[model samples]
Target: MGGVTFTAGGSGEITGATFSSGQTNATVSSATVSFTGAIFHNAVMDSLVVSGNSSLTARNCTFTSNGRRGLYVETIYPQGLVTDCHFRDNQEYPIWIKANCMDMLGAGLQFSGNHYQSIAVSCSAGTDIQRSQSWRGQPVALDLTVGSTSGLTVPAGVTLTVAGPVTALCRRFEVAGTLRVGTGNGYQAWLTGPADTRGSWEGIHVSSGGVLCLTDARLTYATTGVSANGATVTLTGSRIVNSLYDGLSTTSDCTVHLDRSYLRLNGRYGLNLLGRVTGRVQNTELAYNGSHPVYALAANVSCLGSGNLYPSNGRIPVGVSCALEPDLTESATWTAQSVAYDLTVNPYGTVLSIGAGCVLTLSPGTLVRGGGVDVHGCLEALGTAAQPVRFLPLGRQEPGSWEGLYFYPGSTALLRHCQVYYAKVGMAITSAGGYVANSQFRSCSGPGISCAGTANPTFYRCVISDNQGVGVYTRDSAAPNLGNLDSAPTHDDGYNILQNNGQYDFRNESSVSPRAQNNYWGTTDPAVVEARIWDGRDQAGLGRVWYLPLATSPAAAFAAPVTGLIMAGATALQAPGGNVEIRVHLLSPASVSLRVCNVAGRVVCSVPDRLTGGVGERLILWNARSDTGRRLPAGAYLLELTARSPDGPSTRRLVPLVLR
Candidate 1:
C-alpha cells in the first residue's frame, strides 16, 4: 500500500530531514498514517501536519527544530494518538490544535525544549487536564492574548506560569483559577518582568465591552498590573502589587469596583484616574506608594467606607485629604486645621451654627465637601495666594458637588484670596452684604455669584473664569458692586479679570444695568466685551450692563489710547455705501474689520481690510452686504470692531458702530 500503515505492535523510524525552506517536512491527510516509533526532526514548517479525516497514531515520536509550529492537528473529525511524543525548539506553539478536534494524548507526553507548548481554544463540552500533567516548555516570546468564545477556566491548585504578558481579548475573561508569573511558593502572584520605574511591557489591556473579573487571585510586577480604558473591571479578594506606574489605571468613564483588595508597594500612585472616570474603593488596602494612593486629575473616586487606609505607607499627599471614617458635619467656628475627610457645614439646622463675630479660619488644603456653609453668623476664610481653601465633594471635584456658602439676611462673610470651585453656586447671598476680594470662582455648574433678594456684595480684584454658567448673575434688584467702591468707583479700580465664561460675564436680570467698568475681558476690544456681556443689548426686555472705560490689559485700564487704526464714527454711515475712516497713530501692521451684527448677535456684514503704515489715517468702505450675499435692509445693526494695532498687551480702542 502507498500509505504507511503500521499495526498496533509494529514500529517505524523516520529521521535525518534537516532542511528549512518554509515548507512542511511531513504531512498526513485523508489517510491512515500510523507510526509506532517515528522520529521526525529539523523541518522549517510544522514537523507533522495531520488534518481532515486522517487517522494518525504516532507512539514515541521525537519532533525537534520545527520552524512555525511543531504539530498542527486541525478540524473536528481528524484525530491523532500520541502516547509518548517529545517536542522541542519550535517557533510558535509546539502543539497547535484548532477548535473542536478529537485529539487524544496518552500518558508521558513530554515537551522538553519547545517554546510555549500550550493549547488555546474554547470547548463547549469542557476539557480537563489532571493535576499530574505539567508544562515543560521553554519561556521565550510567549505572549498570549486569549480570545475564546466560551469561558476558559483553570481549576484550583494548577498554577499556570505566564512568562510574558497575558491579555484577554474576549468579551468576558473570568479567572476562577490561579495564574502565576514568577516561580515562588508565596501567596501573591509574581510577575517576572523588569521592575523599572518607567515601565517594562504592555501588561494586561482589556478592550471596550471586555470584562475582567478576578476572584481570589493576584497579579504583580509589570509596567502596569492592569490597565482598562472604558472597560468594566472588578476585583474581589484579589491583590495587584509591585507595579511600576499605577497598580491599576482607568480612564474615559470606566467603572472600576474593588472590594476587599490590596494594592501595595507600587512605584507611583496605586490607583490613577484620568478624564471623567468614576470608581469605588471599598475596604481596600493601598499602601507604600510613591505618590498619593489615589491620584485623580479631574476624575471621581468614591471611598466607600472607613476600612480603606489612605496613607498606609507614606505621608498624606499635598492635595488629597485622608478618607474620613464617617462624613463629618460641622457648624461651629472652624479654625486652622487639616481637613482630611468629607466635611459638611451646618448639616443639621442652626444647632451647630457659626455665630456672630466667630471667625472661621480654614487652613490651606482644607477640603470642605458638600452640605454647604449656611452662615447665620460670620465666616472669615482668608487664605494665601499660593494655598487656598478648596471646597470639594466626597468623591470627585467636578462641578455641582455641593451647595455653595449661603449667607442669611443678617450673616456676613469676608473671603480674601480664596477659591470656591466645583459647587452648585459659588456663593449665594440674600440681603446680607459682605466683602469678597482677590478671590476666584471657577468650574461651577451654576453661576459664579448669584446675588438676589436685596443682596449687595462688593467684589474687588476678583478673577472669574471657566464657569459652566454665567460669571456673575443678578436678579430682582440684586446689585453686586464690582471693583473698588471707593471715591473713584465710577472710574474703575481696574482689577477684576473675567473671561471665557460659559454664558455672559455679567448677566443682569434686574431692571437696572449695573456698573462693571475697568475689568479686563481678556481683550482690549469693546466689541468682544459687549458680545460676552448678556444684558439688554443682546436680549429684549432686559437691562444692559454698563461696562465702559474697560481695562485694555490685565489688571489695568486706560482711556482709549490715541494710537494705531481708530474708527472715527459708526453712527451716521452713508446709507448703503459709505466710507468708515480709521485714523492710524503709530506705524504698525494691523488687522481691521468693520463688522455689522444685528441685535441677535449674528454677523450681517464684514468689511475685511488691513491697515499698515505710519501714524496717519486709513479708510474702510462697506457695500452693506450680509454674510449670505444679500443686500441688507437698513433697520438696526451693531457695528463694532477694533480698528487698531496688532493684537498684544497694549491698549486698543473699540469704536461703536450703530448703523441706523
Candidate 2:
C-alpha cells in the first residue's frame, strides 16, 4: 500500500518497517541490518534471495510458499553469526549454504549453536548417502539413490531390521551429514517410504565413517526395521516399533550408540550384532521385542573380549549391564558362568551376586563390586585381604561364579580391604546401604558404583575405575541420592574405620562437604592429612579402628563392653589391626573350655567354662594371644564355644555358637 521505498544505510536498524514481497531483492549495503518482522510472500519471483557483504540478521520472519528457497544466500562468507532464526514451509529448500557454512565454514566462520528444521538439503552430490565425502570440506548436494551408486543420501553407514510384519521400500533412501532427527521436526523432515510388496527394506548399506544419529525420529519399517552394514549409527532418545525383522543389525566393526532410546514390538530379534561387531549403549529401554532383547556374539571361535555394552537397567540377558541402574520396582536377576578367567568389575556398586562354589575374583588392586550383592537380597562377600576377594574365575577362582552382586533395595553393606570382580554389574545397588575405606571396584560393567532408584550408599578410600556408566550418578528423585559425604581421611593414617564407614555416605543434597580428623573415611580426602595417596589409597598401615556392637545380643558384650574389635551385627570380632591389642572375656561359659581357633581349628585359647554365666561379667583375658603363646591371624576369628555345663560337658553350640 506504500508508494515510496525507504532505504537505510551503515549499521542501520529497520525501526518499525514491515517488508512485503513485490519487485526486488533485500540488499544490506551496510555491515548489518536488524529486521524485526518481515513477511516475504513471493508473488512472482522464484527465490527470495538476500545478499549482504557482512550480516543479514532476521529475528521472527515468516516465508511461505516461495517459488524457490525461502531465504537463499550466495555465500554467508566469513565472520558470520546467526542466532535465533526460524525457516519453515517453503516450496523447495527452506535454507541453503555453500562450503562449510557451519564449520570452519570460511576462516572465522563459527556455528556456536544453531537449530535447523525440515531443511531438506545437501552439502554435496553424495554427502549424506556416504559416497565418500569429507566432513570439513564444502556442503554436499541432496540426491540420494543407492550405493556410492544412488548418489548421496542420509541414514548412511548403518543397518536396520523390522520386528513386526509390514511392507515398504525406499529405492532412494539415505541419511547423511550430522542431523539431529528429533528437534520436534523429525516427522516433518524424514521420509517414510510408500507401501510396497508387503516386504520391508531387506538389506542395509552404509559407507565408511558415516554416522546416522536419530533423535526422536520415528521409523516404521513394517516388515524390517533398520540394518547397519558398517556405519556408525546412533539412535538417541528415539523410538522404533512394530517391525518384522529385528530393530537393528550391524557388521564390519561398526559402532552403535543407543542413548535413552527404546525399541518395542519387534519381529525376530530385538537387536543383534553379528560377527565381530561392537557397540556401546546407555540409558535405553526395550520391551516386547521378538525373541530376545539383545543378541551379541564376538568373533566366532571365541566370544571373549567382545565389544562392551552397558545398559542402566533394561531387559536382562537380552542386554548388557542390566542391573546397572536398577529401579526397585523393575530390577531383574542376573547370572554369569565360568568365563575361563576372573570376571572383573571396573566400577564400585556394580551388582555381582553368584551362587555357591562359583567364585568371582579380582586380579589385584583392580577389582570392584557394586551394589546388589546377594541373591537373598542381603549383601555378602566371602573374601579377605591376604587372599584378596576374587569374583570371576581364576585359580580356586577361575571356574567363574554363576552369580554376581545383587542390589534389591532396603539392603546395605560395609566392605573393605577386598577386591570384587568379574560379573554383570560390578556392584548393583539393589538395596539401600553402602561401604567404606580401602575398597576398590574396577573394570566391571557400569559406573563401577551405580546409584539405582532403590539405593543410596557411600565409599571410602575406595577406587571405582573403568566403569560403564557415570563414575557417580543421581538421576531423578525416584532414583534419589541418599547423600554424598566425602569426609577427609580421619584415621591416624587417613583411612576411615567404622562399621558405619566412619562417614555418612548417602549422596543427598547433590553437593558435597569435607570430612574431619580421626580414622579412615569413605568419601574423605587424604590430602587433609599428610598421609594420602593420589589413587585414593591410604599411606597409613591399617590405621587404628575400634568398633562396638550396638546389636542387642549376648555376644554384643563378648568383647565385654567390647574394646578394639571390629563389630559385626551382634558380635565384636576383628578388623585390620594396628599396634593396638584386642582383648576379650567370656560373658558366659558352656560345659567345656572355649578356645580361640584358627582356620585349622587348632585351639588358640582355653577359656574354661567352669566359672562364667552369660553376659554376667565373667573375665576372660585374650591379650591377642593363642593357646601355646603365639599371636593370632589378622582377619576375623570366631570365639570357640566349647561347653561344660553344670549338668555335664557338651559340644552342641560348636557349629552355631549360642550367645549368653
Candidate 3:
C-alpha cells in the first residue's frame, strides 16, 4: 500500500510504516485516514496529500521530502490535522492548503528544511487563518481572521486588522497588539458580521485547552467580544468595547481574570459568568453596558478586588451576590464574613451591628461608610501597611458627616493599620475592650477615641490628629490604657501620637485625673499642654488630664531613653558669679534643662533652659543665676538636670551646689 490511492469513501488507521520512492505516496478522495508513528519519504513525490472532501489526521508522523511539496490539502471542503510531524528537505512548500479546505496545524509541526514557504494557503475569502503556534506580528498591518486554531499571539506595536469575522473554534486567542475595527477606522481590528441578532460569524470562541489572554490590547465592535467555553480568559491593561453582544461571556466551568482592564458600551452585560464560572475582577472598569456591568448566574461565582468602577447606570446583577455585607436598612446583626466591596450603612437609624463572637473581616482597601458600626461582636479589620481599611462617610466628607464605630459593652474590635475619618467620633467605646494598633483617626468632629463606662481599649502605635474636637476623650469610669509603662524590657514599645486637634488632645471629664502619659504633644512646652487640655485647670468641676512625664518627640512616645549626668571636676558647684560646668552623657538627642531649688523641692530658678545636645557627652556651662536674675548668698542649692529625648522619657539628676 506504499503507492495506494483511495478513490472511494473509507476510514482506516495506519501506524509505524514508511512509504517512499513513489510518484504520489498516497491520495485520498472521499476517504478518512488517521495515522500515528508513520513515515513518508518522498524520492520524487509530487503530492503526499489529501483531496476531494477527504479528512486526514496524523500525529507523530515524519514526511521527508526530496525537492517536492511535502503535504497538500487541495480538494473542496477537505480537513487535515497534523501534530508533532516533521517535514524536512522539501524544496517547495512543506504544507499547502486550498482556500476552501481546512487544516488544523497543531503544535510540534516542524518544516526547517523547506526551501520555499513552510505553509502556503490560497487567499480566496481573504479571511484570517487559524494558527497553532505562537505568532510574532510585525509593525505592518496584518489582515487576518483566526479559524479553528489552537491560539494566536500578537506582540506589542503590531496592528492586526481583522479582515472578516474572526472565529476560534475551541482555541485560545491573545493579542498584545492593537486590534480594532478595521473598516471604519482602519487602525482597529474588528469582527465582521451581521449587526442583527442573527449574526452567523462566531466571534472569538475559546474552549477547552484554550486560554484567551490580552494585554494592552484594544478589541472593539465584535458580535461578541469574547466567548469563553470551559476555558480560561485573562485581560490585563486591555479594553473590550462596542460589542453587539456581551463584552465577555464565561460559561461551562470557565475562569476569567481581569486586571486593570476596561469594558465599555457593550450591547449586553460587560461580563457574564454563567454555568459555574468563576471570575476575579480587579482594578478593572466596566461601564455603559446595555445590561449590568457584571451578570452572574449565582453569588458564589466572582470575587471583587480593589479599585473597580461600577457605573451608576449599571445595576447589580439580580442573582449574583455582591462582595459587600448584606444590604440592610435597619439595625441587623452581622455574622462572621468577608467583605470584598465597599459597604455603606444606610441612614434612618440603621446600624450595622456585628453579633458576638462573629468576626467581620474587611478586605484591604474596602471602605465601610455611613452610619456607625455597632460592634456587638468582634471586628477584625487587619490590613497591611500598603492597603488599609478605610472607614469614611458615605455622603459629606466633612467632620461629623456620620457617626463612627460604637463598641458595645461585651463586644470588641481589632483594628490594625486602619483609618477612620470624616466622622462624628472615630470610635466610641463603652464597657468594651479591644486593641487598636497602627491605626489613624483624622478629621473627626468629636474625639478620635472616646472611652466611657470602663472601656479600656489598648492603643499602640496609633495616630489621632486633626480632629475638630478632642483627640482622645475619657469620660466617667473610662480607663483607656495607653503605651506600656513596664520598667523591664518589652516589645510593647509603641505609643499613640496626638497632635493638631482643634480642641484638647485629651479631655478628662471624670472626677479623677486620668493619666494620659507618654504621648507626644505637638509642642514640648508645658504651658502649651496646660492650655490645650480641658482638665481641672480649665474647669473646676471636671477632672484633670495628668500629662506629666510627657513625651518630648514622636520617637520618645514609644520607648524611654537613658541618660547620665555628672559634675565636671568637683562635687561642690558655685553659683552666682562662679561658673559651674556639668557634663551630660546621652544615648540619644535630647533637650537639656537645669533647675535650681532651695532643698525644699521648689524650683527657685530655671538655671539653663532649652539646652540642646546630640548623642555622646556634652558639657553645659551655667552662670548660676536665679530666676530673679540676682546673686544668691552662700547656701546649699539643689541643682537638677533633666534631659529629654525622642525615644523615651527624660532622665533627671539632682546635685547640691554651694554658693560662696
Leading candidate by lDDT: 3
What are the runs in model 2 whose C-alpha is more than 4 Å off?
A: 1-39, 50-56, 60-69, 73-118, 122-124, 128-226, 229-237, 242-244, 256-260, 279-660
Model 1 misplacement above 4 A:
1-25, 28-46, 50-110, 113-142, 145-198, 275-279, 297-299, 303-306, 311-660
How do the predictions measure up, each by TM-score?
A: 0.36, 0.32, 0.43
Superpose all Cα atoms of candidate 3 onto the true structure and report the RMSD in Å to 1 decimal.
19.8
Candidate 3 least-lDDT 10 residues: 562-571
Error of 2 at 101 (Å): 4.9
Q: Clashing residue pairs in candidate 3, if any?
A: 128-145, 180-188, 180-189, 180-190, 181-188, 556-646, 556-647, 560-648
**Candidate-wise lDDT, in order:** 0.56, 0.38, 0.61
lDDT of model number 2: 0.38
Per-residue alpha-carbon lDDT of candidate 3 for residues 1-660, written as tens digits (9 for 90 to 100): 367687768887889878777787777778888889888776476547777778888899887774477776766565667788887777766766553343355556666666753355443332333232223221222222322342444334444443322222212334434333223222233233333331233456666545566665666666678887777778777777777778888768777788988888888778776755556777888888886676654222325555677664244321232223432211221111133222331123344555443445555555555666776555667565666787877666899987888887655566767889988999999867666767889999989889888776767667899999998888777777665454332323335688888868888776666656676777788888777787677678777765666777775321332112111111123334586655554445777788878866777778544567675445577666668887555677877777776555665644556666
**Ranking according to TM-score, highest score first:** 3, 1, 2
Model 1 TM-score relative to the real fold: 0.36
Give the runs in model 3 whose Cα sits over 4 Å from its true position: 1-193, 196-219, 222-239, 243-255, 259-396, 402-419, 430-432, 437-439, 452-454, 474-478, 484-515, 520-546, 552-660
- What's the CA error at residue 653 for candidate 1, in Å? 53
* Model 2, span 468-519: residue lDDT tens: 4333333222232212223221211222232221121222222222122233
Which digits, one per residue and each the tens of the lDDT, describe model 1 over residues 576-621? 3443333222224455555677768887776665444433233455
